[model samples]
Target: MKSPYSAKIVQPDISLSICGYSKVLEIVSNKWTALVVYAMEDGVIRYGEIRRRIEGISKKMLTQTLRQLERNGLVKRVITPSVPPIVEYSLTRLGESLLGPMRVLNQWTKENYSLVEQARASYDQAYYEE
Candidate 1:
């Protein structure tokens, strides 16, 4: 089964010119990054909370995403003094700046979700439904 990624091409010039796109490609390109961001959208959340909210994200992946997002200035890491040291992840003001585009993305997904499901159903029916 050839997948869409098999057709995904790397464009050097465009990748270089568009810093915003490059930033997205650099940070959110990871499978778990957007999900992690979405998880933190409501408010500041902890590691365990985020991990539980987003299913199937391994500890390593979540850790790496958090670090990358932190490095990208989109997320801030807070460590508290507690019985066992509490760590929380929150979006920085810079991260808050992404709200508009993220909201737009969410709206687009919501609006087109049914269409995607239909496409997937048709594709699955054609390919593997037998």
Candidate 2:
């Protein structure tokens, strides 16, 4: 009954080893992080453009999200010397690597949105209506 994949798994010492994945999840799982990443998918974009594209994201939230992404090395920030300094944000290679999986997830959400709405309606009728 031994699992074939068990040999491939490395057991970590819980006391000493930290889960790096949870840290990544914490970064991407923020309310506007994924949207910000998606907004930058089409090459370098200016701050105002990102704000305009992602409707309803407050200035504060977008700024914080970009800072976190930059801190995580997933985003690159470029500053141009001009009368008014121009700032642009673009995805790093690491950020680009996440695009495929993010796109898949986005597709799944688009495909399943109606099913999810139906499920929510059914649940509400079953619980709230009674």
The numbered model that scores best in lDDT is: 2
Highest TM-score against the true fold, candidate: 2
Candidate 1 similarity to native, TM-score: 0.72
Candidate lDDT (C-alpha), each: 0.88, 0.90
lDDT of model 1 at residue 7?
A: 79
Segments of candidate 2 deviating more than 4 angstroms: 1-23
TM-score of 2: 0.80
lDDT by residue (tens digit), candidate 2, 1-130: 9987677647644532367766667778887988999999999999999999998999999999999999989999999999899999999999999899889989999999899999999999999996
Model 1 lDDT tens row, 1-130: 9996787676644645566777577767788888998899888999999999998999999998999899999999999999999999999988888777878988999999999999999999999978
